[model samples]
Target: MTASLKRFAATLWQADGRRFPAPLSLLLVGPLVIGLCVAFILPVGRLLAVSVWNPDFTLAEFVHITESPLYLRILGRTFLLGGVVTVLTLVLAYPVAFLMARLSGWRLAVATACVLVPLWTSVLVRSYAWIIILQRNGLLNSILTGLGLTDAPLPLLYNELSVTIAMTHVLLPYMILPIWAALRTIPRDLPLAAQSLGANAVRVFFLVVLPLSLPGVASGVLMVFILSLGFYVTPALVGGPETLMVATLIGQQTTELLNWPFAGALAALLLGITLLLVTVFNRFLGLDKKAAS
Candidate 1:
């Protein structure tokens, strides 16, 4: 058996006369490529097919969704929510990220734990906790009454503000970690050099550090914005019926209304928009370069 295997190996190597690593490389990667196509690509393709073309390959679903004022309104609202959340996360995460980059040893670990501890907690639990705090007769109202701020409890839960706040909290880590990594890569000397050249700390950060770390910030914003677009639970639990996002609309169509076609179409539209935005980010920000580096 050994003699026969040796003869076969020699014949195979002689037949193609190629490097040894090339065949092994293809053998290693082929399964991964096939798995990705089967798992992600095929499902996304079917979603797109259902969205744009209904039974018998018609564009009726696309027309139905795009031409309706209600659908357009929901789409506009989804985008607005995502935009607001992205901006708020940036504002909130930047200071956290800056502090993380500047800290060291136990301080760095403690700060990182502070950022990640909330993420480790369940979103449902957090949402419900917010509900308990924000309810009419909840902790917030009690505190307000104690401070003599108001005569009675105020309505805080089940509104757009609550949704925004909850989402910002949920998605905050996604924005912070990447920006912190980028900020950390920047040499400490660069800021010192800027200072020596008569630039103030704010000027140095805005001019020197921020631009260089922009790739990470942009990447984080892209992820948070896209994730915000599909958020369902927080808005559903906190904002109630008045603040319905497209994900909730899709869920209602699929489960309650028994309209799979419309749900599939909506899901497909969301996937397309997200992919397009990510592609644009990759193109504009040299995402590949930053990632490789």
Candidate 2:
């Protein structure tokens, strides 16, 4: 087997002029590629087939979706929720990441723990934690009442605000870690150089820091937005019926209604849109190229 691999590597090296690494690398990655194709690609292809092939190839499921505004509206709402959560996480995470980048010793450890501890916790636990905090008589309301902020318990749970807050909390780490990684790569002298050039702190951040750290920002936005689009637990727990999203709608069709074909259609649609968004991000940010290197 060793001799056979050596021969194969030699043949590939001679066939390709680039380098031995270029042709010899496939052997290392070949098994994982095959595994993904068998486990993920084939199943997804079958899912797409199921959506359009009810007895025979037909567009009925897709046509039904287009004819009714409900699914499309829910999809739009999903995008809006994702955008809101992504923006919120970015705004909140950037400052946290900046602070983390500057800290050292125990302070750095504490900051890192603050970002990662919740990430290691269960999503269900976090969702329910929010429910407990935001419920009508839960933590926030009780504190508010004690402080004389309101005459009675506020309706905090089962609303868009509650959903947004929970999602922001859950997704905040995704935003933070990427920005932190990027911020860590920046040299300390760059900021000092900007200060020497008579640039104020705000100007230095916007002009120097922000542009240098854009790749991390792009990565964080992509992750948070994509995850938010498919969020089910947090929204379902803390949000009302009026706050329906694409994932919840898909879940209803798959389980309650037992409409697998329709559910498959919705799932396929979501998958398609997610792929398109990823492609757009790759095109704009060169993330794919950066990742490959």
Quick one: best TM-score, which candidate?
2
lDDT of each: 0.88, 0.89
lDDT of 2 by residue, 42-102 (tens): 9878878889877778888888888888878888889988999999999999999999999
lDDT of 1 by residue, 1-293 (tens): 99999976675454555655557667778999999999999987876666656457776776798999999888888889999999999999999999999999999999999999998999999999899898998899999998999998888888888899899999999999999999999999999999999999899989999998887798899889999999988999999988888999998997899877788888888877888988987898888887777
TM-scores of all predicted structures: 0.86, 0.88
Cα lDDT for residue 102, model 2?
A: 93
User: Which whole-number lDDT from 0 to 100 does residue 48 have in model 1?
Assistant: 65
**Stretches > 4 Å off in candidate 1:** 1-35, 52-56, 289-293
TM-score of 2: 0.88
